[model samples]
Structure formats: structure tokens, C-alpha cells
Target: MQAIIFVRLFRLLLGRQGPLLLSLLLWTALGI
Candidate 1:
């Protein structure tokens, strides 16, 4: 369940300045 959402977010953010933003998002997600 989480993996699926992670993958979708990864794809969506891949084109952006992703490393920092991605880590932040992943952290926030996990924090939830």
C-alpha cells in the first residue's frame, strides 16, 4: 500500500528538484 503511493509520488516528482523534496515528502509520509 505504501509502496504504491511512494511509486506514484516518485514518478510525479521525478522531473522536479526531487532529492531534497522527495526526502522531505518521504519523511512526512513516514511520520504520518
Candidate 2:
């Protein structure tokens, strides 16, 4: 399913970008 693919992509991004990705997510959530 699409959700599974998204989870896999998220994992890949976390593996590659780690903290940078997490910070970006927080900023996006805060609308900054």
C-alpha cells in the first residue's frame, strides 16, 4: 500500500539524514 511505501521512504530518509531530517520535520510542524 501507499502507506507502507511512505514508511519505507521515511526510514530511508532517517537513515540518511537522521538529525537534519528530524529538525526539518519539527520546523515544518511548527510552521517555521
Candidate 3:
């Protein structure tokens, strides 16, 4: 369920790749 939502949100934000990647990377790094 989490992964499914994540994929959806990921695609929703795809147009802003730079910010999206940075945010995802930051969130992942924070262990959230």
C-alpha cells in the first residue's frame, strides 16, 4: 500500500525532477 502510494506521488511530481529527486533523497536519508 505504501509503495503504491509512493509510486503515485512519485509520478505526480515527475515534472519537477530536480526537486522531486532531492526531496526523495532527503527523506530516504532521514530514514523516515
Candidate 4:
């Protein structure tokens, strides 16, 4: 499912820029 993939990506980016990536993801999701 998309949620699973999102979680995986979240974990991957967490070490680098988790908050930034999370905000971007949420922003994109809301934009669509």
C-alpha cells in the first residue's frame, strides 16, 4: 500500500531531513 511505501521513505530520509521531507510530502499530498 502507499502508506507502507511512505513509511519506508520516511525512515530512509529520517536521518537526513525527516521534518523537511515530511512537510514536503504532506504539502504535495494536500496540493493534489
Candidate models: Cα lDDT each: 0.81, 0.80, 0.77, 0.84
Per-residue alpha-carbon lDDT of candidate 1 for residues 1-32, written as tens digits (9 for 90 to 100): 89899788787877777788778877997996
Question: Candidate 4: where are CA atoms >4 Å away?
Answer: none
Please, what are the lDDT tens digits per residue for candidate 2 over residues 1-32?
89689768877879866788778877987999
TM-scores for every candidate against the unseen true structure:
0.43, 0.55, 0.45, 0.56
Query: Candidate 3, TM-score vs. the true structure?
Result: 0.45
Compared with the true structure, the alpha-carbon lDDT of candidate 1 equals 0.81
| Better by TM-score, candidate 3 or 2 | 2
Residue range 1-32, candidate 3, lDDT tens digits: 89889767777777667686868767997999
TM-score of 4: 0.56
lDDT per residue for candidate 4 within 5-30, as digits (tens), equals: 97997888787768887888889989
Candidate 2 vs candidate 3, lDDT winner: 2
Predicted model with the maximum TM-score: 4
As for lDDT, the candidate ahead, 1 or 3, is 1
> What is every candidate's alpha-carbon RMSD to the true fold?
3.0, 2.7, 3.3, 1.9
Q: After superposition, how far is residue 30 of candidate 4 from its true place, in Å?
A: 0.1
Better of 1 and 4 by TM-score: 4
Worst 10 residues of 1 by lDDT: 9-18
